[model samples]
Every structure is written in C-alpha cells, then in structure tokens.
Target: MDQPPVPPAPTEQGEPVALSPPLLHAMLEASHCGLVLLDDMARVIYWNPWVVRTSGVALEEARGRRLGEIFPESAGGRLHQAVEESLITGLPAILSPRLNPHPLPLRAYAPDGRGERLFTLMMIKALPVEGGARRTMIQILDISNSVARERQLREQARELRAQAEAIGRLADHDNLTGLANRRLLSELFFKARSRAKRSGRPLAALYLDLDHFKPINDLFGHRIGDLMLVEMAERMKACLRGSDCVARIGGDEFVVLLESLHHEEDAVIGAQKLREAVGAVCRIEGKTLQVGVSIGVALYPRDGEELEMLLRQADAAMYRVKQSGKNGVALTTREEGGWPPFG
Candidate 1:
C-alpha cells in the first residue's frame, strides 16, 4: 500500500495568501484554546506556541507526531477518526463538551498519572495548509476549571463506584491488608500464565510469608497487628514498580508478580529486594517492631507453563524457606538442585 504523501515542512508563507509563522503563532497563542494544525493524514503540521506552552510537548517534537500518537486517550482509533470526519467532510467538527474516560490531560508526565481532565472545547476546521489535502486546524479550550468543579460531583460517583467495587473485591481481597485474597490469586495466576504464552516472556511469581508476624499480634493485639500490615504494605509499595503486583494471599502471606523477566538471575534480584524492604523495622505508635520475610520465586516457561504447576512449585518453595528458617529468597530452579531444599 502506498503511504500517504507527507505535508511539505511548514515555513513562513512568503506569498500565497501570506500568513507568517510569527503572526500565526501570535494569533493562536493569544486565543484561549490549545491550537493544532494537521495534514490530511493527521500528521501534525503546526502545533502552536500555545499548545507547546500548555501540553509541555514542544512545537519541534509535535511536528510529524500524529493526532492519535501524541496523547494517551487516543488509543483504539478514536480522536484520529474524529479528525478524519472533519477533513473528509470539509466541515468544522466541534465538541462542546468532550467525553472520554481517562481523558487526555494536556500536560504529560505530571506527578499524578490519574490526572484531572483537560476538558476542551474542540473545534476542528478542514483547511488547506502546507501541501496536504488531509488538513485541519484543531482548537481546544482548556475547560479544566469547570472540570475541576465537575470533579467534585464526580468524586461522589467515584466513591460509589469504589464502594461497589470494594464490596465485590471483599469477596477476594484481604480487608485488613487491602491485598488480593486466595480467590483472586487463582484468577491472576491464570492470567499470568496466559501472558507468558502470548507474549513468549518469562514470568516470575514470588511467594513471601512474613516471619515473626504471630509474635507481633500476640505481643501487641489484633489492633497493632493491623497497623503492622498497613506499614508493611507501604514498604512493599515503595520497593515495587508500577508494573509489579503485590497481593496478600493470606495473613502475613503475600504474593508478587515480577513481570517481563528475561533471565533467571532477574528473579533472584527481585527476591533480594523483597528481603531488604521487609526486614526493616516498622515504627508504629512510637514503638519500633522488626520483622522479616521469606520469599520463594518460581519462573514461568522454566518451572512450568501451567498456572497450577507454577503456583504449587512457588508455594512449596516458600514453605522450604519457612521450614529451614526465614529471611531469604529461594528460586525454584533445577539448575542448582531443582526444587531447593528447605532453607
């Protein structure tokens, strides 16, 4: 298939109806909306200074970036299709109030990933720009102030959704730890197995049970025990990347999914990190309580392709750590002695 011809690189219009980049930049910048100019193929022809200022994506980088590629919410033939309609019809397409779940916020890589919406009053005008027929100017007003207010009302709705989700999750999540219960584990295990098959990637599962947890519960009370779990969760969260999932399978028992592992050594490194984080003393209510975790790791496509086999192997490996002693990471690898002896 022949690729769509690229738009001539944007330049100061010397003659032909005459619109200078400086003047055009000024006009678009002064306007209250984020402005973008695109070719027939949705190739970015001109992304204005205003858009550069707002989105933190520079005009230089914006050139050649497609309407769908620039933003996160542009997945699955969305906003690109909207642009297609405007160009094809040679009519301005306007959305008075934009509606999209996980709407694209103008600024990228902000501290908050689940960012507030950048509700925009979008106006798409099909026009001749550069040298491409597939061309349009998109104007988006940052209606975030209204969006912020709307977010307040939406907070209640979010809370209601959360409450309902919590009820559903309660069936498969540890209430005290807010971690996945055994039931959820089975589902996750199956999914992980499928991921390994589809992606042809190595997957690692770490089964960790905190050492000396019962002593803390006995020494302090169930109340203090609950606080310790919360503290431990925070510590674990600090150690994990966004891709990893940590679930409390049972009391003081946690499971971690180490994704996209390429080698056997990677699993061992993950186990070490878990040891360091959990070994640290947690200070709660002005009292310092120390605990440790014993972790057993099982690799996918190496240990077993099936979920049941891997989980069973991982669990068995975890118990070995407990039986021998505690505070170490064990990987289920036959390279050493196959199933590692307890401890």
Candidate 2:
C-alpha cells in the first residue's frame, strides 16, 4: 500500500506559503479563466481545465504540440504576434477587446440556450516567466457579457434620442396642418425682427382670414372642413418663397411672414398671390368648394416695431377688409394716414 502524501510546510506570518505540486495543479484545474503555458521552444507544456473546455481540445493531444498546430487560425493573428514578442523580448503584452476583438477562436455556448457556439470576447494577457526555464503564460478572460451590456446601452441611447426628436416635433408643429405652431412662430419672429432691425430692411406680415369657410363647415361636417383647411395650408405654402413662412395661428386665420423684401410693393404682390391661391376651387371628397381670403399687410418699423403690435395692426386691417364687402387686401398705412382700398 502507498503512503499518504506529505503536506507543504507552513511559512511564517506575512511570508509566502509553499504549495505542493499536486495542490498547485488542483488550483490551476479549478481556475475560472483560461491558462496556457508554453516552453522556451514554443511547445505547449501545460494548460488549465478552463483552456481545455473553451478550446475544446484534450490535454493529452495538446501537451507537446505547437500553438500553430493546435490553433491554426491564430497563427497569423495578433495573438501569434504577441506570443512571438513575449518569447523573443521577454516582455508582457495585453490584447484588449477594442484593438483585437476576436484574437482567438475560443468558443462558448451562447446565452440563448440554443447550444450554439459563439466566439468569445476575450482580453488576453501574455506574461514572460522569470524562472529557471524560459516560458510564457497566456491568460484569457471572457468579456462577452460586459461587451454585450455596452452594446445594449448604445442602442438604448439612440432609441431615446429618436423619441426625444419626435416629441420636439410634436410640440413645435400643428398636428392637423403640420404648420409651425405658436411657440415656433414666436421664435421665428424674434429672429426675423432682429435681422430687420440690423439691416434696416422691411419685414412684411400678412394676416389672412378665410371667407365663406364657416359656411362650408356648417354645410359639410368638420371632416371635410379639416381636409379643406389642410389643402388651403398647402396652397398658401406653395404660393410663397422658401424664405417666407406661413403659420395657421387660429381657425381660418393664418399669418404669412416675408423677410428681406426688396420694396413695399413686394408685400402687396405676395398678398395677391396668396389671395388667388387660397381662393382657388377645391374638390375635397368630391365636393366643389371655393373660398376667398381677406389679407391685411403690416410692415416692420412702419406699422409697429414689435411682433404683437404688428400682428394686431394686421388683424385690424384684415377686419377692415371684412367690413368692406370681402375678398380684398388692405395695407396698414403710416400712423398719420392709411392706404385706400386695394386687393
């Protein structure tokens, strides 16, 4: 019968403890990460059970084989370069996931329970041994879970940004006509007014009210009325230049802002074009419908300096058009006097 193995002698306090070869081998076998040891000749000498499990290679078969023979795919890769550097210069090397994502072909079961093989995200370390024999120890840590979490966080950030943009659009635009809402219009007015003040150029604000619109709503239901409103908004936008803005401030009440005008007559021309475009016949839902507009023009610094003052004067002028028959345009004249009847 064989005798029991002797235990390692205990060291003094704060000193290193000696472990027997069998205990060291046992610890290595139970390690959680991969460990591969190569001799000076670059031949596989020892490897932990973790390496065996991940690489799917038996210990007996890989004991004396070269790394190139064991993992052919890693022969011309970063791992091979790192191993060569460590063996020649006796310097340590680290291969991070960012630089070398899949340096090795080590496999693991996917987390989805499908028993599919997934190439692991590994952080590899090659350390040169400073012992009696020249050797290199390679350590591999699986970082698949961490990498997956980082990817998920990036995707979530993009999704959140998209949602925020959608919410911003909803807040700044009218839902029915997709025109600039009050909030956006106020901001636009501020910018336009500032530019007009600096350049001494005139800015025109045309306040428009659709005539015969209420009759359509009363005769037909609100559905057809809504379609008409949308159609009218499109027509008004088409009649203006890209630099101009048209906003539906209220039901049947729209405001057009024309910037960088060459002359005061430009406002009248724009107003007439809008009047014609809006007064055109619309066949919405097979119903022949026609409407007219009463437009009131207000000039910057001439009518009023502020946006509210200009809008108010323009609205007042529009009301004057409404009182005098209908389907006509009126320009807010100087404080001393006003323009005659015009369309």
Candidate 3:
C-alpha cells in the first residue's frame, strides 16, 4: 500500500538492516519466500531459512554447490541455459517452463516418478552489474493449481467469450482484490482512447490514490489490509458501469477510464459516484479502517491526444489532490507541465 510492498506472495517481517550483516541474515532467515542467492558462475552462495523449509536442504550441504548438483532430478536445464545466455549476451532472461511436458519414449530418466510433469515453475532473472558478472535471482513458484485451472480454462474458453473475462482471474485481476490490474488497464485505456478519437467523444482517465492505506496496513495485519482492498474494489465496481474500466495500478492506486463520453459531465458524474461510494469506513475481521480516494482527471484531446500524455496528466492530478488534502479530483493543463517522467 505504501509504494508497492516488496514482491509477490507473502513475506516474513524482521528488524531493519543498516550496516549490519547479522541483521540482514536474520531478515532473510525469516522470509516466507524461498530465497537462494547465486554467484556469477551460478553457484549457490546464500540459502535462507525459507529455502531450507521448501527445499528440504541444509545450508551446509547446499552452499558451494551448483544448482544442477542439488536438483539433479530436474532435467529442466532451462535455468542453466538462461544463466549462460544472460552471462554471454548481457541480457535478462525470464522463463516459465511448461509444467506438463509430453513424455518421450525414453522414460528411464523420468525422475520424480511423475513423468514430464514439473511441480513448479521457476522464474529466474539475471541482474547485471556494471563491472562484474550478473547475479541471477531465481524465484520458484508452485503452479500445480494454476496448471489444473488452465486445463479446465482451455475447455471452457469456447463458450466463455461473451464473458471471456473468466480466462485468467488471477492473471487479469489484482491478487488482493478481484479487480482489473495495470495490465488490463493498459489494454482498456488504449482501446478507449482509440474509440474516443474516432467517434469525437471525450475520453477521461481518473488516477486514484487511496488515502490512509498504509496506516491501515500498519494497524491491521497485511491479511486484513488485503481484504480491505478487495472491499474497496467491490465498492468502486458498484459505482461503475460494466463498460467503464476500473483497474488497480499497483499498491493503493486505481484508475477509472471512461470511454464514449460525449461531455465532460459524464466522466465527472462517474467520478462523483466513485467518490461517494468509497466514503464509508470498512470493517475487516473486527478491525475498522478508513480510507478515501484522491482522483486526478485528464480528458482526451482537451487534455492531450497521446495515451501517455493523458495518463501523465491524470497521474499529476492525482498527486495534486494528495497534496491538497484528499477525497477530491484535480485536472492537468498545458500551461502547467507535461508528463514524460522518463526520457
């Protein structure tokens, strides 16, 4: 909620680290995500407590060993290949290997006794250093559930196009809330901008920042904080039409992209509805938390023609509203500034 809290799944909390190695080790030792650090040569340099828990390996045994040595049963040398390529090519590599590969005729080497079915999908990325070889960070995710769901989804796709939105609920929606995320928002935003340009209708983007969200996380555990986000997404959805796009843009932020609006009032009315809808306090599992939405509105053609331009204006308006107090909307202007935050 406070500027994106770490990476996916859950994490174990510990004390802060400054110039402390013991404290840092303690932190990693406490994390829920299985963390394994590798060197330039793809050798295990550091293995954490979660890794031990998930992998059933001890540090004394794992350290000074290569990944292939430890997981010899894993015929998927895709991780090694990725590392070699990244080292030589100076590029990043991310691969989610298929969980269930077709078994070949030669089955003597079928370790794990599950044929070609992989229990996990390992996501590895090489982070390059300027004067040194890149360090490859590998995160292994259990996707057995996802694999089963995908198979079921493949069969259901033919009849679900009317609401094909059911394809990848976890992929398309925010993890905490069943709301569309930035990935979907980008798709919808571009479509709306295109249609508005062709039909001469005003397109508006509302970038919303949730006020007092971090405080809620601090007061309540992350479990309840996640529930609150889901509740907020539901409330916003109630205020929006099926055609209008509302998406979570990471952390405590959401954007409402209104399309085919002939007048500014249409978008403004939608914004007002969302504002009123999010006004009430939410109670999650005996904890009462209050959060409000700060909206930044930017109109197409009137604001800017480019999608990036419109988004920038909207984002600027959101930050402006945050600066002014909260629970209100602001606009962008050509005379003020433009957003290409990155060159």
Q: Candidate 3's residue-wise lDDT over 1-343, tens digit each?
A: 1245333433356544343578667878877555667878778888787566556578889888887788775434666776667656656555563632311111212345334333455556665564775676666555556777888998688567645555576677777777787777778877877777789988888888888889888877788888888898899988876678788877888888888887887777778778878878777887667788888888876877766677777888778888888888776755433533544
Whole-structure CA lDDT of model 2: 0.82
User: What ranges in model 1 sit over 4 Å off?
Assistant: 1-163, 333-343
**Candidate 2 per-residue lDDT over residues 1-343, each given as its tens digit:** 2246555565677565667688789999999888888887678999888877767787898998888888887777877777777787777778877677777667674454344233343432344355756788788888777778888999999999999999999998888999998788888888988988888889998999999999999999899999999999999999888878988889889999999898988899999999999998889988999999999999886776777888888988888899998898999855422433346
CA deviation > 4 Å runs, candidate 3: 1-169, 336-343
Worst 10 residues of 2 by lDDT: 116-125
The CA lDDT at 15 in model 2 is: 62
Provide the clashing-pair count of each candidate structure. Answer: 4, 0, 0
Task: Tell me the tens digit of each residue's lDDT in model 1 across 1-343.
Answer: 2346444455576433445578666777687567788887778988767677667778788788775677756644445667888878776766665364323446423465444446666777776544545678887777767777888889989999999987998998878877777788778777877777888878888888889999999999989998999888778877877767788877788888887777878888988998898898778898899999988888877776665677677787777888888788887756422544456
Using TM-score, give the best candidate's number.
Answer: 2
Report the poorest 10 consecutive residues by lDDT, candidate 3. Answer: 100-109
lDDT values for all models: 0.75, 0.82, 0.71
Provide the TM-score for each candidate, comma-separated: 0.50, 0.82, 0.49
lDDT of 1 at 6: 47
Cα displacement (angstroms), candidate 2, residue 88, comes to: 3.5
Model 2: lDDT of residue 271: 97
**Off by more than 4 A, model 2:** 1-17, 39-43, 64-75, 110-126, 129-134, 335-343
